[model samples]
Target: MSNNTSNACINDSTNQINIIFVGMYSFISIVGLILNLIALVVFCNNGRTRSHTVVYMTHLAFADLLLILTLPMRIYYHLGFTGLHQWMCNILGLVLKANMYSSIFFLMFICFDRCLAVNFPMSAPVQKWRKKAWLVCIGIWLLTFGASVPIYLSKPSNQTQDKCFDSIPVFAIQPIVVLPTLFVGFGLPLVLMLICSWFLVRAVRRSTVAQTNLVDSSKISKMITTSLLVFLVSFLPYHATLLLLSLNRHNITCPMLDAHRYSLMVACVNTVLDPVAYYFTTDTFKKKVDMGAFRRMLPLNSQSSDLTRRGRVAEDS
Candidate 1:
């Protein structure tokens, strides 16, 4: 892939855009961070979280929290608030990449765990699977760390007032490096998550028929399905654009740069969008939110479910 000299040449316009991105990230990161943290606290305080799903929710919160922790550096980096230094770039890139990949892997884990629980509910209690599940989560983090370390180890670039530059050799952007990241970070994980969610939905539907006390599991299924779909819908476009850009770098023109920037912005949106996905997918989070604790922690107001129910009933009638 070839880099466009004009695009690579960062100008006042580029700086303005980056600043705007930082602003957006700041708002998103703070909101998502606070919500996930509240979820974590509620999980700890409530005794209702002994289920396997709640355990997964805890780890999911940790992954998201780790990602949120790194957002300030990213915001600063894009804002040009930080000194453009090699170590800073390396460290920031490493932490961000690690957390991102870890989150992706954990999404896969949650989907798979759900699938397993639904498919094998009669064999053994899910709590017995908890220890092994944690081990698997740790293993996923280590594996993702291994795959993502190169992003940090790669040479750093400096963004000056006059221009944006990478000290790393241009050849470093070769398909070899780019392809692996696209696969590990986007492609493979996307495929695995989709497969797992599919199986999970099917398993849940099948198992629900055998369980007598369970209400219709459609709500839970919808939550998982929507979460995974959001991940796909939000991230897939960006990855597709990146892959196209990677493959046709030599011919990319100035007009395309605008689209590329937008795509990058979309990819960055994941930093904010993920918490919404987490809140929807995890039951413990919904319960806490329903109990008004979530609104109490934030400055938001909670409307009563009774009013909502009345509205729903009127609509249905």
Candidate 2:
């Protein structure tokens, strides 16, 4: 009787947690959809696609938009609406995971582009590759889809009683798939982002006056800092929890499970935060945003070159 009661209590607790999660997902889905849609429209207007950074950001917003679109089914599933066929689940799951990784890689690509602009400003390949950014975005989408195949194949055909968006048991799938995903999907990209950020900082410090003027140094600094923060605060915890859950073979304690749930939600919150990053980082996007309001909220150092020259002349006189 005691054992049965304990099990009942645990189930009730899990259900309540799922309810809260569903509510949060609904909110994020609505807000993320709107923000990303606006971002796409802004990026598409006025020939903004010509810039490499805008091209990457436009794709990133599209990926996030798709990810948000999957949330309604998830919300419904969590609210006890069942009877979904296995294939439907698999397709939804595949798209969700694929786009999640797609957003990660595209953000990494943006970082790499910025790093190149800062460190190799005069390089021919850097100048030449801007036109080919669309091709690179296409390759990223293909690679993301390819990586999702293992997930689709391994997912169970019947999960009527299973929790929505739950992780598959680690032993059920080939280690090859799981291990590579942990490394490539999260670890490798994270390392590359850190390296790019380090190089970008160094380049900014060594930049000449002309280079600094060409790209707003303050904006670059803000972009790199925000990107690193997003990776560290949002993505890192979620991946760590996933790694631990997988390593423990689905026998993790309740606290760890809760941590995993919360961390995953935090990671999803990145979809909304990304627009803020783009506004600060992308010159074209920044231009579209109301400068008066933006400056009032986050004022830039406004001492102009002419003002500095006048001050110097005053001192000399």
Where does candidate 2 stray beyond 4 Å?
Answer: 1-19, 167-174, 209-211, 291-317
Given candidate 2, what's the lDDT at residue 178?
59
Any residue pairs clashing in model 2, and if so which?
none
Tens-place lDDT per residue, model 1, 1-317, is 23445436344344343756677778768887877787677666544324455555667677767766766765665665435555655565566557666766766666666556555555556536744766777787788778667655655343342332222223324588678767877788778877867765665566553243432355546656666776776567766766666666676555455555555556555656655765544444565566765554465653433212121100110
Pairs that clash in candidate 1: 2-249, 2-250
After TM-score superposition, the amount by which residue 81's alpha carbon in candidate 1 deviates from its true location, in angstroms, is 4.9
List per-candidate RMSD values in Å: 6.7, 8.0
Q: Per-residue lDDT tens digits of candidate 2, residues 1-317?
A: 12333334345543443667788888889888887877776666525124676778889999988888878877876776655565766777778778888989898888887677666657788768855889999999999998787767866555434344553333323456657877888888889999998887776677573254455556567777898887777688877777776666435565556677677777778788888765444544555454332332344633212112221100110
CA lDDT of each candidate? 0.58, 0.67
Residue 199, candidate 1: alpha-carbon lDDT: 67
Task: Give the local distance difference test score of model 2.
Answer: 0.67
